[model samples]
Structures are given as C-alpha cells and as structure tokens.
Target: MTAKLEKTLGAVSLWGIAVGLVISGEYFGWSYGWGISGTLGFLVTTIIVAAMYTCFIFSFTELTTAIPHAGGPFAYSRRAFGEKGGLIAGLATLIEFVFAPPAIAMAIGAYLNVQYPDLDPKIAAVGAYIVFMTLNILGVKLAAMFELCVTILAVIELLVFMGVVAPGFAISNFVANGWAGSNEFSFGTLSAIFAAIPFAIWFFLAIEGAAMAAEEAKDPQRTIPKAYIAGILTLVVLALGVMIFAGGAGDWSKLSGINDPLPQAMKMVVGHNSNWLHMLVWIGLFGLIASFHGIILGYSRQFFALSRAGYLPKSLSTLSRFKTPHRAILAGGVIGIIAIFSDGVVNLQGMSLTAAMITIAVFGAIVMYIMSMLSLFKLRRSEPNLNRTYRAPFYPIVPGIALVLAVLCLIAMVWFNQVITLIFLAMMFVGYVYFSMTKHQRENAEEDLMLVGDNH
Candidate 1:
C-alpha cells in the first residue's frame, strides 16, 4: 500500500506555509532589482510581477481546489496534456523548488554571519539544511507549526522594520538615479526594467507553492482559496512596504548588492550599535528561516509526489514511521547542500552563485507558471463538468493575464541572462531524457498488470 501524507493543515497553517515559502524575499534577493533597475524602474517591474502573481494565484486556486493533488502543477499538466506535459511541469517545479532553497539557505547563512563575523556562511547554510530536513522528516504537522510560529514573528519583524525606517525615509534618496543607466526613462531604462524581472519576481516567487500542500490541507477546496488569496495580499503589501521603506531609508544603491539588505538598511536609520539594528538581525533570521524551512517542505513534497507517480525512483516515495517522505526530504537536502558548497566555484554569466541560483529558480518558476496556466485553460475546456469549488473569477481574462505576464517574464529573463537560460534548458533536457528512458518501463509495467488481471 502507498504511504499517504496526513491531513493536518488548516487555512491558517496553509497561509503560513504560503507566506513562509517566500518571506525571505522581503529580507534579501530582491534588493538586487535595485541594482539593475534602480528604485523606480524596479518598482515598475515589481508591480507587473505582483499583478501576475495576483492573477496567477486566483486562477491557480481553481486547479488546486479541483484536483487537490500533491503533485500540484505536475498533476494538473498530466491530466490536461498527458505524460510528456507532466514531465515538463514536474521537472520545472522540481527545479524551482530545489534550486530556490539553496539561494534562500545562503541568505540564511549571510544573516547569521552578520552576528558572528567569524563563522563561515556555507557551514551555517549546510547546518540549516540538516536541521530543517530533520524537522520535516519528523512530521508535516510539527514542521508546519514551526513554520507558522516563525512566519508570524517574521511578519511582525518586517512591520517593525518599516515602522522604524519610516522616519528616516526620504523621497530624494529613493528617487536618486531611480532609473537604471539614466535619471530619466529611455531605451536603456526599458532594458534595465526588463533585466530586473527575475529579482522583481523574487519578491513573490513561491506563493503558488501553497498548492503542493493541498493534499495535506483540511477542507482544501475551501481553505486553500482563503489561504492563497490572503497569502498573496499579505505578500504584496509587505513586498511593496519593505522595498519602498528600505529604498528611502538610505542610499538605495548601497543596499542593492548585498544579501542582508534589511539589516543594512536598518543600520542606516538606527546606527550600527542601536538595539533596533540588533533586533533586526536576530529577529530578521525568522524571515529567512521561515522561507528556508518552508521551501524544504515544498520541495520534499514535490519529490515524493513525483516519485510516487514513477517520475523518480520509488525509494523517494517511501514514508518514514512519522508519516513523512523522509527519503524525498533528504534527497532535496542533498541537492541544496551541494549547491550551497558550489557557491564561488560555479558562476553563470558572471553572476554570483546566489544570484545565478535565484535566476535559475525563477526560470523554472516561469516555465511552471506558463505550463500551469495552460493546464488551467485546457482543463476548463476539456473537463467543463469537473467539480470546481472555486472557479477563477473573470475566467479567460484572469488566467490570460497571468499567462501573458509569465511569458513576458520568461522573455525578459532569457534576453538578459542568456547563459543561465541555456543552463536551465540543459537541465530540462536532462530531465526529459530521463523521463523518456523511463516511459517504456512504466508502460510495460502497466501492461504486465493488465495481463495479470486478464489471467485472474
């Protein structure tokens, strides 16, 4: 018998997981947008991306509620377009979920290194993988409870950050060189805005990851819509608030390149020695930990779901005594840990490892988003009679907007980051090769089962 995941998540827990999966964005990664597009330009990129997410989530909820599958996008695509489409969506999602954690984990290490300057960030990153993977392996309920606690603290800390920095915020500082490559909008500024797409995406990248938890959610059809809608609203408010406040607090350019922009921005307002700065560092960790821990859970579930369906080795589908996919959890951790160590050695398009990883993850996410929206549209026509507790408001228009924005983001990313785009394509090619090789085996197994049934 297949070992199944326990349903212990309520709307609140699902919301926590949704928000927590991407909260690290508020703390870091996104400042890189400021680097490429400046404040105003990146703001435009963010607004576009935010709109995409808002629409995507609303439409995505329909599929999540209807299917209530752990495979998330993979399951949706499989039902809509069959095994090949499932392979594409599953691989894209796996890449997104697996690659995102290392980038977040590295940021976690960077946050810790602020307090203990002597400690190596990579070691701390590996430690995080070990700790969170263990927590997830123990049980989903325990992992989600911890995620909720940290997510709440992280949200509060971000509010405090905005409050404390509000007084120091200056319109002049924020708008200074607000457009990348020029003070005024031009062709260059347009290029910069497009270049900033991935970082802008960083703000709300994994919000759709909530769908992965549908199989484990209590009254998922009802609870998931609530959790998803609320989660996106919360993230948009926080992302806008944090970015605007952080930019205006000081010379936004100075904060653009670093991983721990929140703490650095706070120091400009509160002074390096102030208690508020210290609190931001310690409390700020909750935000990073929340994302790091939550994404671990998300990726492991994807692994388990894929493996259980024979997309991966079946060993990964085996649940621990605690009713968790321990092997899957460990498998993703091993990948993330390997990525953490590959930091300086592997550079894509002259970008730092963290930036490259973020870009790669965004690449996966965009592909998955495109596939998911297509799946949504296909199912709407193909299975019109399918029960949907929550239909996407505005139908074609809503999902159409999401599909357009996702394709645009992909175009911008591929345009600006050619090398990383190739790398991403290479990864997909490899996954496809594996899938093709395994397809005949799966078909044979099915035929054998049919034969046995005939004899019986």
Candidate 2:
C-alpha cells in the first residue's frame, strides 16, 4: 500500500504547514540558549545558524522538487544509497518528526500553566495530543486547513508579542552581562557557544518538515520549492525579531531555561499578574499547537512512507476511511505520549527527560541534514540524467556549506549534549540491529512497491 496523503495543500497552505511546524521553536526552545551563552553570545550563534539554514533549505529544495515524495529524506537517501542508507535516513526522520512533538507538548503544557497555574501541564499536553490526533485522523484536508488557520494566528501573535515587548527593548538591558554572563569571553564562553548551538538551531529546526508533505501538495514540483524557500526566510526573520526583542525586554536571564519564554518576556513589561500577560500566555498556545499539530502530520507521512516500503509493518501504511494515515498517526502519538513519562532514557544518566528528548530530536535533525545533502550530491553525480524541474543554484558550494555546517552542528551536539547524543546513537543502533535481523524479510518486497515517491 502506498501513502494516500490527500493532495490538498497548495503553496500558501504548504507555507503554513512548513512555518507551522517550526513556529513553536520561535516561541520557546531557543530561550534555553540564553541560559547557556547569554544574549550576545546566543545572538552570534543564532546568526551563524540562520545562515546555515538558509543554505540548507535552498539546497534541500532541489530534493523535494525533484523527488516530490512523502518520505522526504527517506526517498532521497533510499534512491541514492539503497537499504542501509535508507534505514538511517528514515530512522533519523522518525526521530526528528516523532520526538519533537513531546517537547512541543511540554511547552504547550507550560504555556497553559502560565495562564491558569492550576491545570497540570501533563494533563494539558495529553489533551492536546488527543485533540490534534483526532483532527489528523479525520482527514488531511481538514488538518491542513486547521494548520493554515492556527499558523496565521500564531504569526500574528508573535508580531503582537514583539509589539508589546518593543518599548522595553533596550540595547543596555540586552548587553548586561550578555557575553557568557561574565561581560568577557573566556574558554568557558567558547564551550558555552558549542552548548548553545542546538538551541540556536531550534529557531529553524523543523522548517524542512514541509518537504515531508510534498506528496500531499498540489503541483509538488512548483509548490514545494516555493513553500520551502518562503518558509525558511519567514522563520529566519521572525526568529531574529522575537529573540532580539525578548532578550532586550528586561532581565533576559529571568526568561532563560524556561519553556514559556515568550510569556516570561511579556511579564517583564506587563507584570507577572497583568491581564496582558495572561492574554499573551493564552495566545502563545496557538504557536505551540500549530507545531504540535503540524509535526503530527509530518511524522505520520514519514511513518507511512517507511511502512509502505517494508521498513516497518506494512499495516501502518493502510489509510483510514478518511484516507489519512490514521494508524501511523496514532502510533506516533503513542510513542510521544510514552516519551513524556519515560524516565528510562538510557545514557542520559541524570539528564532531565525533557532536555534529553529535545537534544535527541535535534540530533536526528542534524543527521538527516547531513545525509540528505550527501544524497543530493550523490544523485547529481550518479543520476545526472534524472528528471529535474529545479536544480540547486550554487551546486557544490551551497550544499557544501550546508554539509560542513551540519557536521559542525553534530560535533557541537556531541561535545555539549553528550548523554543525550549518546541516547540518540543508542536508538539508531537498535534500529539498525532490527533492520539487520529483518534483512531477509526486506528482500521479499515486490519491485513495484520498492519505487520511491507517492506513485506506487
């Protein structure tokens, strides 16, 4: 069975899905970097990361346009490197798309708690999963429509948040003990930058998720490229705007290391118990929900793609009456829910489960980035005559830069997020082992079902 993702997403809807998948990163996650490197230092790292994402997105567009498959990187790497490479790419996509929701769910819970302070965050998170997963199962069209609605509202919310915090934005407040919190750079400061890299990357982590929906997109060749490019630029600008304003609003450290970073920044201007603060917190839920919902859509398609190709149980590839990947959606939701309560994240040693999950998700993203870029180069050389509607502009240079930055990002994560990275590697190893043992089973697949893209 092939992935039956409804091709209801046009370029605008695709933009919404792409930006929606990552807007929460703007609203949360990145603030954790402030605790690591302070404002000035994180700003430096964010600039470098924005540059990397710009390059990566541009290079990745070619793959999405040329292949136009729901499997995204799995399709790219599978065609280029066969089963072993396909497993690595597909598993990493799973980690990136699957693990991210729990983190976003935690942020959703945190945002609700900021507003009410009585509702348990975990309860709210589970409720979010229930609500969004139901919507996802109902239909892909409805899900994409909802994605467009919330994504627009979330963008407006961020702009309004920046407006509310703008008057408090001061250069002096921003630089106060900003450089590694010591007012000077040291070896420790350099270490902090490395630690801060993942959070910096969080600003645009899942924007590439739009590519995962290529099979469900209208005119995938044209719409996918436009959506990916538009989505990345939008994220880069908004990330900078929110980070700069939020950091300058007041004692930025007060907002550091928190899941509800936007609300914390709002409280600096409006007071802790201000009505505006409460409203801001309420509005923040849309950002979190947009990502939570959008990524659920992403991971399901990926799961469908893998299962359809025999990397997973083919049963998961079956579509529901509504034609959405219902079983796959539910499977991913179950995994994320379990992750919320999972204290047994082995190799994190003593790391907080939330931190470990986020780090693992980022690790997955880095791996896909490297593997996908390599797939791009390999395809260019190996399949020179393959059909192509678009080619990466800078060829070797753009992808070359994205590749080097991806490796650097991986090294940074390994150096700083040791236990979490270890946990991620352990998961990958287990997946490879399972794939190894199932090698005979994989070989029995029909040649027709082995083809990439949604055409099967």
Candidate 3:
C-alpha cells in the first residue's frame, strides 16, 4: 500500500528548502563563467541572467499557486496544452533534475579530492548518492529539515569565504584581461559573453525547484509565492557577493575552470595548502551537499508526479512506509551514479563530461522555462474563471522578459554546445514517442488508482 504525504512544511521551512535547493550554485557552478568571459564579461552575463530569473520566478509563482502540484512546470504545461505537452515538459524537468545532481556529484568528488587525495573521487561521489538517497527515502519532513540546516551552514561558509578573501581584493586584479584576453569590443569578446550564459544561469538555475514541493507544503497558495520570491532574492545577493569578492581577490582565471572555486580563492589569499584552505575544503562541501540533497528531493517529486499521472510507470509513484517517494528517489540516484562512473563514455563532441552534462541540464531548464511562460500566457486568456491566489507582478511583461531571455540563452547554447543541444533534442524525441503510445492506458489506470486512496 502507498502512504499519503503529510502537509507539514511551513513558510520558513519552505524558504529554507527553496534556498537549499540551489545554494550550491553560489559555491562552485558560477566560476565556469569566468573561464569563458573573465570577471567583467561574466558579470555582464550574470546581470542578464539575474534579470531573467527575476521575471521567471514571479511569473512561475502565479502558475504554481493557482495549480500547486508536485509536477511543477509539468503540471502547468499539462493543464494548458494537454498530455503530449505535459510529457515534453515532464521530460525536460526530469532532465533538469536528473542531470543536475551528477554535475553536483562530480563537483563533490572534485572537492573531496582536494582535501584527501587518496580518496578516489568517483567512489566518494557514489557514496554520497547512496547516503543521501537513503535519507530521502526515509521521510520528506526529515529530509527538508536536513536540507534547511545544511543550507544555513553553507550560507555561513560563503560569508566566511568572503571575509577571508576581502582584505586581498584588488580592483585591478578583477579587471585584468576581464574579457578573457580578448581585444575590447571585438567579436571574440562578444562571443565569450554569449557562451557564458549557461554558467551565469547556473547561479540561480534550480530556484524553481521549490515550487515542486508545493504538494507537501502547508497552504501552498500562500506559502509557495512567499518561498519563491524570498528564495530568488536571497540567491541574487549571494551570487553577486561571492562572484565579485572572489573575482577581485585573485586572477579569477586560475580558479575559473575548477569545480571547487572557493577553496582555490582561499589558497590564493592565505598561501599554499593553508590550514584555512584545507578546512574550507571539507566544510565547503556542505554547500554542495545542500543542493545535492535538495535536487534529489526535487527529482523524486518529479518522478512521482509523472508516474502518478500516467506519464511513467505507476509503480514508481508508490510511496514507502514513511510516505516518501522511495522508488523515485532510488531510480534517479541509480541513473546519477551511472552517469558519474560512465562520465568517460557520455562525452558530446569535444566537451568534457561535466561541461556536456551541465549544458544539457541547462537545455532542459531553458525549455521548461520557455514552455511554462507560454502556459502562463495561455491560461490567463483561456481560463479567466480559474482561482489564482497570487498574480504575477507585471503580467505579460514579466513572463515576456523571461521567455525572450530564455530563447536567447537557448540560441547561445546552440552556438556554443551544438552537439549537446542536438543530443538533448534526440532525448526529447525518444521520450515523446514512448509517452504518446502509452499515455491513454496509463491515464485510466492512474484515475482508478486515485480512487483507491491508499494510506499507511
């Protein structure tokens, strides 16, 4: 028998969970942008991406509140464009959640390698997935509370990282070849900025993950918007703070391509293998773990939602004794573990496994953003009588900004990582074909299961 989920999460917990979902972005992912465009150039990318997220979160909140479901964008697009549309959206989300964790896991491995060179990074990464997935399977509230606590620790470490690096900061260092050694206003510099979009968007990539928890929140209509807004604001502050301070403290280019940027920044300030740097190497992983765990929660919910709604196997939707989506969590974890070990085989064109995966994940996120915004515009005109607890501020304008920027980013990814973009499209095509053939039978089964009302 499947257990029912409890609605025990409150506003504060919701905010924490939301922040936890993407806090690691501040820690490591954004540094890759500096590799492409240097400090000033990446800053341009960050500002534009920040603007995109601001519009996206506001518009996303309205749709999430009006129809609070664990499916997140999948649920919204499903309502607006029917089952096939929903399947596409759901697959995109699955890509976002599933692919993201492997990147985080790879980052985790790189961090551990920095601290204890003897530890095989891949083994440690697989261990992390094993430990965290077990915690996720045990219970949702426990997992959420754990996420909140680790997120707080991560936030504190980021502040401490800033303090340690601040005294050494120099404006000249930040601007040194700031456009990645390109001539001023040249096509090379412009091209670098466009290529930096994925890394910039990584700064707040999964802030939308919070909305996926709506089904388990207390009074989601009120709690969902509050969490989304507060969460985005918090991330913007952290992203800029860390980026500017770290960029100013060092050459910026040296740490640009690494998975563990903060520790490298500390090394520049304090000296080689400084105790302070070594300490951060261990503690900084809390930041990665926060996102690692939180994203697991997100992907599990997405898997459960699709399964329960006839988009995937009905068996995957069944809750455990603790009322958590255990099977969903397990399934995603297994795929992630495979991705980590098989990283050697998953390369696209000339991109490294980590870069290819990150770009592919961004591809999924951008698609969902574009579709979700379209769904918001469609529903507003077609479903005038629908109850909406919160309206997106700025109406079509907010979603319009997000949609345009997302499309631009998509264009950027195609130009920069064409092979991975093509690979992502192939994945979508395969998934759509499978979903279309099985959906009707699955839908009827799902409706019947809903009537069963399983508990304990």
Candidate 4:
C-alpha cells in the first residue's frame, strides 16, 4: 500500500510551526545587517522587507487554502505554469529550506559556546542536525508539539530580553552612525539600505513554510488562514521590538557580524557574569532550536512531496514505520551538515559563512515569493470558480505589492552578493539538468503506477 501523511495538525500547531520556522531570525543572522547598513539604514531595510512579507503572507494564504498540498509553491506553480515552473519553484524552495538550517545551526552552536567556551561550535552544530533530524523522523505530532513548546518559550525569552534591556535603550546611541556612510540620507545610505535587504528579509523568511504542513493540517482551509495571519502579526511585533531594543542597548556595532547578538547585547547591560546574561544565553537557544527543528519539518515535507511526484529519487518518498518521511529528513540533514562544515572553505567576498548562507537562502526565498505571487495571479484567472475558503483581502493590490517587493529584493541581493548569486544560479542549473534527464522516466513510471492502481 502507498503511504499517506496523517492529518493531525490544527490551527494552533500550524501557528507554532509558522512562528517556529522563522523565529531564529529573532535570535541572530539579522545583526549582519548592522555590519553593512548600520542601525538606521538596516532599520529602513527591515521595514521594507517586513511590509513585503506581510503582503506576501496575506496573499499566499489564499493559494495554500485552495490547494492544500505538501508541495506548497511547487504544486501551485506546476498547476499554473506546468512542469518547468514546478521544477523552478521546487528547486527554489529546496534551496531556501535546505540552506537556512545550517545558518541556524551555526547560531545554535554560537549560543552554546557562550555557556560552554570549551565546546567546538561546529561539533555542536552537527550534533543539532542529528538530534532534530531524529525527532522529525519519529512522527509529525511529536515534532510539532515540541515545536509549540519551544516557540512559546522562545517568544517569552525575546519579551524578557526587551524588558531587561528597556532601561538601557538610549535613543541617541541607536541613532548614532545609523546611516552607513553618513549621518543623513544620501546616495550612499540608500545603497547600504538596499544591500541590507537579505538580512532584513531574514526576519520573516520562512513564515510561509507553514503551508508545507497543509497536507497534514486538519481543515486546512479554515486553519491555515488563522495560523498564517496570526503568525505574521506575531513575528512583525517581535522583529521590530527585538531589533529596536537590541540596537538601543549599547554600542550596536559590537553586536554586528556575530552569531550571538542577543546575549552580547544583554551582557552589555547586565555584565558578563550576571544571571540574566546566562539565562538569555541558555534560553535563547530555544529560539534557535524552534526554527531549526521546524525548518527540518518544512524541508522534509517538500522533499517527500517532490519525490512522491517523481521529481526526485523515489526512495526519498518512503515513510518510516512511524509514518514520517525518514529518508527526506536525513537527506536534507546531510546537505545542511555539509554546509555547516564548509564554513571557511566557501568564501563569498570576505563574508562569513553564516552571512553567505543567509544570502543564498534569501535569494531562494525571493525567487519563490515571486513565483508564488505569479501563481496566485495565474490561478485566479485560470480557475475563478475554484473554492477559496478565504480570499486575499485586496486581490491584485495585495499580491502585486508582494511581487514588486520580491523582485526588488532579488535585484538588491544579486547586486550586493554577486559571487553567492552565481552559486545559487549554478545550483538551480544543475537541478534543472537532472530534471530534464529524468522527465521521460518519471512519466513512464506514473503511467505504470496508474495502471496498477486500476487493476487493484
């Protein structure tokens, strides 16, 4: 018998997965924006990116409700534009989901290193991959419940961080050198803001990943909209709150270009040995883990969906006795582990591995966003009679905004990170080649499977 995914998730679990998938952005990786754009410039970049995500999610939710497929964007794009579009969307999403974890894993290692100075961050990162991948292979219910627990704790920890640092938030400090090259708005400051798009995008990069769980979500039409709307609102408040407070805490420059910015910001306020600093360092790990674990779920689902559809190796679609996509989870984990270990070997214009990975992931995310918005438009025209439980409020205006911003972000990312952009394109080229080679075989396999189903 062919294995099917169990439908056990509800609105609440979906919400947790949504928030957890992107919460690590609240912890680290975003500070790299401060390195290039300074406080004020990056803030501008963040606001623009945040608006894009808000619009994107609100519109993207409509497609998720209408289709409710595990392939998410791949499914939507394939329906709208055919097999080639499916390949593009699937590859972009795989890149985004697969590459994001290594960056988060590195941050997890960095957070642990604060408490255990003797530990090697790389070893810790690899260990995280092992533990989380195992949890994912166990079952969706177990994995999502764990995600909920950590996401709630992670949200609380960020609130506590803001409160602890509230007293030390001086406006003058935050605004000092806020612009990249000057104290006021200029061509240089504008350039810096554009360059900061990827880091700003980091804040809500994977919120739409919730859609990947639609196949397992109960009453997906009703639940997904609730989860996505709530998730986006929750993240916006947290992202703005955390960034403003962190920047105002002290010399924001000190927090830039590192994986553990929150703890360092807290340490500046409460001293290195303060109990609060230690608390933030330890509990802060939950934030990283939330994203790390949740994204493993997201990527594995994408892998399983693609393989089941014959785009990838059929073995990847196999389910364990526990009913989880075991091979898919491990496959993504192996790719992430390779990325984690390649920290120093893959240099991109003197950028840190974390930053380079973030840029590459953001590139994939932008491409996917553009494709998704286009799919939404195409489907609306092609299937106007389709059942859409919850329609996007503003129609073309809403998704139009998302599409335009995504295009702009992609342009900015490519301009600022040429080497990384080339690598991302190269990866996509390789994936397309593989798809072309296997296309005929996949079609024949589908025909044989259908014939067997008819006989049965």
Model 2: per-residue lDDT, tens digit, 1-456?
334567788999999999999999998888888888989889989988888899999999998988888888998999888888889999998999999999899889888887678998888888899999999999988899999899999999999999998887898888898888978888888888778898888888888888888988889888888888889988998999999999889999988878888888888887887777877788778889999999999999999888877788777888999998899999999999988766454536455555566778889999999999999998898778667888888789999999998899899888876677777889899999888777665665544322443332
As a TM-score, model 3 comes out at 0.95
Candidate 4's residue-wise lDDT over 1-456, tens digit each?
A: 445799999999999999999999999999999988899999999999999999999999999998888888988888788778878999999999999999999999998998899999999999999999999999999999999999999999999999999998998878988998357888888999999999999999889899899989999999999999999999999999999999999999999999999999988788889899988988999999999999999999999878877789888989999999999999999999999888888778899989988988999999999999999898888778778899988888999999999999998888988999889999999999999889864574343221111222
Error of 1 at 218 (Å): 0.9
**Cand. 1 Cα-lDDT:** 0.90
Better of 1 and 2 by lDDT: 1
Point out the worst 10-residue segment of candidate 3 by lDDT.
447-456
Q: Native-vs-model 3 lDDT?
A: 0.85
Q: Looking at model 1, report the run of 10 residues with the lowest lDDT sum.
A: 447-456
The Cα local distance difference test for each model comes to: 0.90, 0.86, 0.85, 0.91
Give stretches of model 1 more than 4 Å off: 444-456
- Counting clashing residue pairs in each candidate, in order, gives 0, 0, 0, 0
**Candidate 4 lowest-lDDT run of ten:** 447-456
Candidate 2 achieves a global lDDT of 0.86
lDDT for 317 in candidate 2 is 84
Q: Could you list the CA RMSD of all candidates, in the order they appear?
A: 3.2, 2.2, 3.2, 2.8
Report the C-alpha lDDT of model 3 over 328-391, residue by residue, as the tens digit.
9999998898888877875577666666667778899999999899889988887776679999
Q: Is candidate 1 or candidate 3 better by TM-score?
A: 1
TM-score of candidate 1 versus the correct structure, residues matched by position: 0.97
lDDT of 1 by residue, 35-137 (tens): 8999999999999999999999999999999888888998888878877888899999999999999998889889899999999999999999999999999
Query: For residue 390, what is the lDDT in candidate 3?
Result: 96
